[model samples]
Target: MSTKHFLRGMATVNYFADNVVAARDWYSELFGVEAYFQMPSRDNPAYIEFRVGDDADEFGIIDRKYAPEGMQKAPGGAILLWHVDDIETAFARLKALGATEYDPITKRGETGFVTASVVDPFGNVLGIMYNPHYVELHGA
Candidate 1:
């Protein structure tokens, strides 16, 4: 691998929500902690950020109203997959929270990777995976 200093490990994952307040509340409740940062606005905030996981990676919820021109609102392209200890529990919890199932857990026979995904209430594709290589490298 080239030693370029660009593109570090998934520093942030962003999802847009039409109802920023409701998204913030739902995510916070699911994450079991309040967001650590938010951008203020006159009406509903433009952006809210949550820092989660042992690595304290950033997960953000943005107002769909602020989406840049040409940003697709459909449930396709660029799903953010988070590394989880238990794929089954993670997938189930998201569904229990009313997230629609997109893809059930699937394992690559040789690669040792397993993944599952869901379409959230706001239409974001959230994926969870058990990546043995990630754990082996990061000791998470």
Candidate 2:
């Protein structure tokens, strides 16, 4: 039997924050673009989103109050590494933007895969990577 590929691709990744507006502004500075969507109302949004990267992947910020009960309010979860053209520059910018280091930059083998992660001020882990394989398929 052929194994079906159930997980197709990444659609959206959301980070929670106590202050959604602040989170939105911070991310906007990093992304250099304003959020194109906000829910409920801009003055009192429960969620906001941006279309990121060449593929326009969904990156969202949600109010912490909307998180499910028992969800951990710390930077511990799956770290989704977004590809960056310059890992060092991107990592440095993240630090300069008030994010703390969660994982330092790490070079993986000789295939040109590098990774780093940081905890955003809102306590969500944000991962950045320099992935050659991804570039080979997607371009810089």
Candidate 3:
């Protein structure tokens, strides 16, 4: 018998936040995902993991204290962008989940990408993007 290991794909992207619980809840509601794991450390305080849809891959939220000091401030411009099939549907779902909508769905050139901005409960800016042409271009 032989044991093999392989890289399937990106599992998650982690963001640092001041309030782990709030961030976790915000992401859960916005992405319609649930936290699969939670670990606490003296320096980091709280670490959480959320799985997207039914996929095994997960997204992570870590306390600012655990991340590098400079990352305390949320990323500027576009902090996070999620690629969905339908922007309008995703936007409505997120809005219903208590997300504050900052912009309406708008197109992006000939690619047919639509995006909107929202702030999470912990003050992190997130974007919901729908680009059907993405997979064809990036080979995802």
Best by TM-score: 2
Candidate 1 residue-wise lDDT, 64-131, digit = tens: 98787898888888777788999999988999998999988999687879999999999999888899
**Per-model lDDT:** 0.87, 0.94, 0.71
| Candidates, ranked, lDDT | 2, 1, 3
Task: Rate residue 45 of model 1 by lDDT.
Answer: 76
- What lDDT tens digits, residue by residue, belong to model 3 across residues 1-140? 64655875566877778888877777776766668788864234489887774345578888877777565464455446777777788877777777677767888788677788776656566677876766566555
What C-alpha lDDT does candidate 1 achieve relative to the native structure?
0.87
Worst 10 residues of 3 by lDDT: 70-79
Candidate 1: where is the Cα deviation over 4 Å? 1-4, 41-43
Residue range with the least summed lDDT across 10 consecutive positions in model 2: 1-10
- Candidate numbers, best TM-score first, in rank order: 2, 1, 3
Count clashes in each candidate, considering only residues at least 3 apart in sequence or on different chains. 0, 0, 0
Clashing residue pairs in candidate 3 are: none
Report the CA-based lDDT of candidate 2 relative to the real structure.
0.94
Better of 1 and 3 by lDDT: 1
